[model samples]
Target: MSQEPDRLFAQPLAQVADFVFNEDVARVFPDMIKRSVPGYPTIVENISVLAARFAQPHTTLYDLGCSLGAVTQALRRHVRADGCRVIAVDNSAAMVERCSEYLHSQDSMFQELLPVEVIEADILALAFQPTSLVALNFTLQFIAIERRPELLARIRQALLPGGALILSEKLRFEDAIEDELLTALHLDFKRANGYSELEIAQKRSAIEKVMLPDSLQTHRQRLLDAGFSQVLPWFQCLNFASLIALP
Candidate 1:
């Protein structure tokens, strides 16, 4: 274990960013991300269903911001075995290192399965192949709003004409009543996940300073501006929404 501060849930923006990028997220991530909701199995199942949309035989799957390879693991099981590859990318150095190590150890067991590769690089700058299926799962929210369109365009350029892009996010509802209800329900979820009211309040404040998530309409428009032929919200749970975009 690293001697670093436990910034996963207690630090300010810059400190947490440094810790996330420099320290192994697999070591501290579960305590943070996994605690965002109750019923881990159900959340995993929902994620699995969303990921299955991109799985195909002999295809290259791009997992942008694949923290600790959780989604990658699910994708491997969802996709066909023959010649499939999962290119898991993250800007966090520590996350990349840990994911690479984990994949290497797990590779031999999955010899007949899809190949998983971990890359330490920015999602916006990496070169994506035209044959890849890109998945931005709970990741695009962290990207700056202004850069989303350009990033989407780049992703479209990297994907084949008919390739798919799956994006899941925490969405803001247009209806006031719906928004309030979801917000309360999501908060209840956090509480059920072992967070105290005080902890939840403090964490929300800290997260707002660091994470910049755009509205659902904005995200949809960006995908359209990027030249995707079809873009639609496919699934929703409270504030969470899964969007599918096809090139």
Candidate 2:
């Protein structure tokens, strides 16, 4: 799909509001994420590989906070389990609408891809079905910290035996020095991706109030506490990482 370059923060603003997944953002998200996030393409592709391993017959796979259905498309393309379907959910109306269009486009091109359902609902309030794989790709960070544990516990309860949850997030290192170094590296990465200093700074200011990151230690403990049998780190680049939690 062709994407417009992300220039929302290219110009100065007297006051920046917390970032939102509205129409303007939804329009430019594909470009924005690719430039802002390191290892994003790899992560999206690998989520399908992990899905093929964990997906069970007659169960559903969920992509929570699914933006434009990238992971959902990957899952549909890779997972061939009988009776399996994918549910992609996002609270943003614009995101859901665009995601539906993208998925429909995929459907027209591919034959017998896994069936999918796209929902415009808050994941925190949605009840999950029997699920074999659940993906929270850079999603949990946007959720309020106090509510995260409950959401994980709910996912755990919904998962069938041997099911897995793939969580990808921006990490916060426990050590101040490590945190600083990794953060600097991430900013450098953005610069290298062609984002100007003003764009980087303004974007950071807009997102800082909304996206709160956690250390790997905190994520591990929280996953264990949520009734996952194991929490394993599968991928990491700079301060971003993806984990698998088996239930």
Candidate 3:
């Protein structure tokens, strides 16, 4: 479904605070993400294809930090595993409320689709079931850096044999020159998407401290440390990339 255009950062703010998934963000999230993130639609759609491959019958699939149910709906649309159900979790009430509405719309429109349960809870606190598929799309960067390994280990422990995890995130390049060039290109992408110069600058200021990205090497090592047998990078657009991990 198409979303409204994002104009949240068009005007200059006297004081730009750290970004949060609040009510305003929930309203404009669809537009904000599409314009701000490169290759988002491709990532969201391919997640379902990956789900179809890895989803085991009667096992649960997870969409952690599911905003407005985009990935949840993708799973609902593509997964064919018998008795498989989706559990979508997020901490923001505003996002959950709107996401539930979207899912209800999806339910009425589709038939014989996998069922989904939306929970207004933190991902770190949930007691995970033995899962066949887990999608962590752009969610890990917001988590506390120190807590990331434990989170991945928990997911690994919860995963059934041959289970898969789809992890997508904005990456930080280790090389200073490459990082500078990519950052500029990403900003140019935002400009092309109708974000004003002030908007791009302000948004970056707001999120720089809150969203902490890791290098690809770091992510690979951590996944290995968490017991994943292999890490395969399936897609990369500018600074964003998605990886599939097998346990």
Find the candidate with the highest lDDT and give its number.
2
Total backbone collisions, model 3:
0
- Worst lDDT run of 10 residues, candidate 1, spans 11-20
The local distance difference test score of each candidate is 0.72, 0.96, 0.94
Off by over 4 Å in 3: none
lDDT order of candidates, top first: 2, 3, 1
TM-scores of all candidate predictions against the true structure: 0.83, 0.99, 0.98
In candidate 2 the C-alpha lDDT for residue 183 amounts to 97
lDDT of 1 by residue, 107-179 (tens): 6667455777788899888887655478787888888777878888988887765568888788777778977
Residue range 66-185, candidate 3, lDDT tens digits:
989999999998999899999999999999999999999999999987899999998999899999999999999999999999999999999988789999999999999999999899
Overlapping backbone residue pairs in candidate 1 total 1
Best by TM-score: 2
The predicted structure with the larger TM-score, 1 or 2, is 2
**Model 3 root mean square deviation, Cα atoms:** 0.9
Number of the candidate with higher lDDT, 1 or 3? 3
